[model samples]
Target: MDKHGAKIVSVFSCKGGVGKTTTVLNLAGIYSLMEKKVLIIDMDLNSGGIAVSLGVDATKSIFNVVDDMSNNRFNTISNYIANYNENIDVLAAPKDPRDAFKIDSKYIDLIISTAIYKYDVILIDTTHILSPITLKVLDKSDSTLFMITNDPVDLKNARSMIAIFEDTEKKNYKVVFNQSKDTGKDYFTLFDIKTIIKHNIDYTIDRSFYIKDIDKYVIDKEILTLNKHIRLIKKGDVTRLTKIAIALLDKKKNNTRSEVA
Candidate 1:
């Protein structure tokens, strides 16, 4: 509710494979360099890639904590968190997809609440599906980055989802045009994509950010932004990501002050 408390950020997409998780981790890497304590909650329960992508061997996960809470076995939140670095901590999803269903949506708020005061930023990685857990995350988020691609199907789906968000008066979201998802999928011009979606593109990830060897980064357990070569070669991309992260957090701070005034 204030500047001292952790700012919740949800990185989401109306369709999958739009660089949502990449954005989350990149932002986390930037925050780490800024000396911010970041907690990334892998909410894509069924097929989450956060732990694996980072190559973190998570022995305990979000499910364990939720189960503990549900059955009165809960204690400190640290029991379930796996440290990714000095500044970044992760709450991984269940290893088994079936376990996704066992956790209650109500526990999402509880988990976040328990960890809220301990972090400077809380980033949630979610699936495209608007499950109860995702809905709860959206409701709790201070700001959200909604990623979209240049694909026709992605635009169509985004347009509909944007319409719903506008209808509900959800003002805490920004549309991120990630052209890097597929460098060759530039079927629509900037104007055409904006016209179709009927929303202003708050940020753009140039196709130049697309790396053919991105898989290698995952294989090597590297955060793109934190990689020295990435910082030198793709410096602009990292800078833009840093700007987006700062703007998202600052926007929430400014809005909070306005409301309190």
Candidate 2:
């Protein structure tokens, strides 16, 4: 699939601990390697891990930006973007849950629109639980990547999320599987996954040990220094994620064409 301009991709999951944050970070890095400018917005307001995943302190967040905007102290989008290497930028989530309620769809559009003008890919990392902010994010995204796992409880939660999206009548979505250990044991098959969730699995990411470094590098903002360490993990999983990202970009293009046609 060919890439497109100003794509909003949300990495989400019905259940927590499904490697949503890891997938977002690695995919953001991979997209950067593809020469696409990427911005990762951490919308998981309660337990914002994107900053921690990248090894940064989550002191300042989207709350600050929204607060500034409300207080007539609005500035450029560059003010909220934290540099994650040359090609990637990050907008951290609020540390306080109370601040999350303050985030509405209108300001989100402003933030996303501002980033879209400057970046090719906008990756939004969302909280696992349902909330107004999360709904706004999903409703606005061009495509949403719903992360799932082999666990039964996770699949059950995924079903709930799918139901909510279905209720909204939004169709731009794909499923991603994570943390498959494959310990030489017979377990849930892809068909089983499809049967349970009733959605096609777009891609599966194998478990990686260097996952912790994902947080370390992002937190410390040591993209260059962590290059060798991250490189040791190979490009397999992230490459797969990149393919899906490109497909999403293409999907949006096709949708636009269909609308025009």
Candidate 3:
């Protein structure tokens, strides 16, 4: 019971290729399995791939919904929502990149407000660019998961972003280090990252957990379904992801309770 009616979590990164979308998909899947009503909004309008990654048809998208909104199409948000399963829904990005420009940033507030009433949790997968739309999405989020990697460039960009966040007093953020691989060689550790960014790394996801046959999974549209014959390592990865989802939900619940008090 979030005070805002729904808990919005925005997964963002200043750098790309850090597995942000993958993280959103897995977290949404885990929450869905827990019987939570989850909605994923692909805010990466220009090159969003949430629908394609999940192998779902995107006949209608946020572009259409926002276009309708601009034309006073109230209560039509549900029309563009695509069902991923019984527990999860998606508002995909436009099929054509050019259609993204038709959407105005002002409509984001309305879109999010509509989603809050329908979803228990809204997961926003945003583009790496810091456009006005992205800023609005971040401002509306209850929690922001900043995705990063072990790469130097990623860390540097994250540090710069963290500085901006601090300056703006945006404290509702958790840093997630993705695709982390340790070769036992002399490499930067979590402490080093914290020291560099002046913020603690909240979580680390192993690189091995990234599906090698991700393209095939997308084609099969079973990215969320766990295979019975999956290796033990993959199973462990799923368990870890479930824990992360639970933690996020618990945090939201606590925040809601505090707000009510």
Candidate 4:
């Protein structure tokens, strides 16, 4: 979509433990601060945590909506999302893992389209696996954020995927290095990482963003960007994340209408 138009941004990673979900939540927090209505869709069907981490009790999930759509029982987007606050809602992943497999990837376009008009931005947290579902999410996304860490294996895998994006001329993707995940694991410098991956690091969350009590925040259902102490303690980090969110909002991209609908 064009700048400021309703758009979907997909956050995925080379692997599962790379802080992909955390980035999504923090971006949603930043968007809320900007007073933009946001929908956070947990597409990591097997073990998504956006709903649980945010403490939003979603009775109907993405799977339910997809199942309803597949059976011609789907109605409106209102029936699926769980309200986190006035500006934020969540379309959770399946509560049961098996339900994930039953969700048809074909309906992803319809799911996103049904809700795109109702929100200023949709942040989709997808599984690291490149399943059919993930492929469709990437296709529908206005931009994709690839989260990476300082791990050797993760960087290697990222290099491979980013190479493909480069070869295919996918300019709508960004590489966000999450140094906060394992603060002490900064074996490779930023220069080395860019050299290895052959892609510039679009954003970096430094070790300063790392929290020793991250579990406490999760337990208390705290969004780091929304927490006063975190905002104060990690002021630069918060500002950096806001920049990423703002970039996603400002980039005029993927304005073409839905082909599936």
Candidate 5:
């Protein structure tokens, strides 16, 4: 696809607990701020958290739309996607894990195509472990961000993922290193992890300013608005994240600028 055309990007890895949902939520926020029509779909049906992270309720989910689509009634998709801003929409995951398998490849394709027609960017957050649904997402994605953390197990999984997709259809994959601890100790830097994995690291997010004591948000089904104090302190973090989002969407500009200057 071209620069103006719609694109699907799935954020995945071979392991769990690597801040995948957090990356998706923050990136979606950045894209929304850029005024792009963005739709974030949570495919981690086992236990999705996009709604909880974004401070939204899960009364209606993407599963409802999938069921409607299977029965030839897709109008329900719009009904379930909770709108965060004028440009951002979110399709929450299934409340019941069993409902996830109910959605097959064809249904997922329909969901993806319909989403592309409606939004400029469709961001999918799949289960960390490789599964049939994850494969389907990978096959359909125009690009992907394989997430990893500083942990050795996560890095091992990252290597396995790069090896698995080495011959796959989606070769335009990149790496995102999250939850970096800058404790004045020269522990494994992003470069070290990149070297081990043998893939060019695209993003390295510093671990800081996580929302504390917010577990109740899940049960309350509330939207996770940044607390006013945090909004002020983390303004720089937000700007940095927005820059990453813009760079991802404008890939050629980087190469062209590098050549010219």
Candidate 6:
């Protein structure tokens, strides 16, 4: 299967409030700082908030582009994109919840295909709701970051999701534990989480100063800006994000090399 010249990653979780959007924004920001052209698609159709959270104008959205495409009014996705910076662009979700109903699953394939040629990476932020659209996005993704927390409910859902992926023979996914806190409790330890989920946690973002102030930073649209005087803990968080970005790029490069061989 051709990747259409870009690495497509979908940030998804089975439970809400596990920091899916936050992870997407931070990852996009890190990639942008690395000078890679990035495009972020808000796939949380029902309650899409990427545009508002990032302070980008959302007068036009994916819904509008799909509508135009369906009517043969347009063949390109360039017009629907809002430029976020030199290296990052955003394709916002529908401004109205009612418009989300018009989005067909077929349009997602078209959007990703058109977007691949225009950007080095396409990041999709998905809702927790396991709708047809969400499943389709996961199916189309080159890599799926399965975001999860240490909570029992979240772990249970993650385990179920993993079971589905296993049954479908989908292996291009990594488990990411986010907003992890150390409460000196053995029950919620890394060992316990792995034991319950039956999968090793590939990465973890422990509680950090930056995460604590994430709400304010997102609201102010300053999430992309790294503070020069950030505390050690926050700096560690940023470093981990950078490492994650590097890991993704490395995986893509390896895949390309193997394909060539």
**Total clashing pairs for each candidate:** 0, 7, 0, 1, 5, 0
The full ranking of all candidates by TM-score, starting with the best, is: 1, 4, 6, 3, 2, 5
Model 3: per-residue lDDT, tens digit, 1-261?
356477888899988766788778878878777788889999999999899887767999989888777778657577888888888889999999999888888888899888797788999999889888888888888788898777677788889999888777787777887763332322577788788778888877766576656667667766543444443558877887777777776664433211100
lDDT of 5 by residue, 19-55 (tens): 6776676677667656778889998987998876766
How many residue pairs of model 1 clash at the backbone?
0
lDDT of 1 by residue, 92-160 (tens): 999888999998888987999989989999999999998878877877888888999998988999999
- Per-residue CA lDDT of model 4 for 1-261, tens digit only, reads 234446789998888888889889999999998899899999999998998999998679998998898789999989988988888899999999899999888888798888887889999999889888987887788888899999999999999988767665666778889989888897898899999999899888888898998999999988889999999989998998888888887646434322211
lDDT of 2 at 90: 83
Give me candidate 1's TM-score against the actual structure.
Answer: 0.95
What's the TM-score of each model vs. the native?
0.95, 0.82, 0.89, 0.94, 0.81, 0.90
Q: Whose TM-score is greatest here?
A: 1
Write down the TM-score for model 2.
0.82
**Ranking of candidates on lDDT, top first:** 1, 4, 6, 3, 2, 5
**Cα-based lDDT for every prediction:** 0.88, 0.72, 0.78, 0.86, 0.70, 0.79
Q: In candidate 3, which residue pairs clash? A: none
Q: Show the lowest summed lDDT stretch of 10 residues, model 1.
A: 252-261
lDDT of 2 by residue, 151-174 (tens): 888887787767766665667777
Model 4 ranges with Cα > 4 A deviation: 1-5, 252-261
Clashing pairs in 2: 53-215, 54-218, 54-219, 55-218, 55-219, 55-220, 56-219
CA deviation > 4 Å runs, candidate 3: 1-4, 180-187, 230-232, 251-261
lDDT of 6 by residue, 190-210 (tens): 888998899989888866523
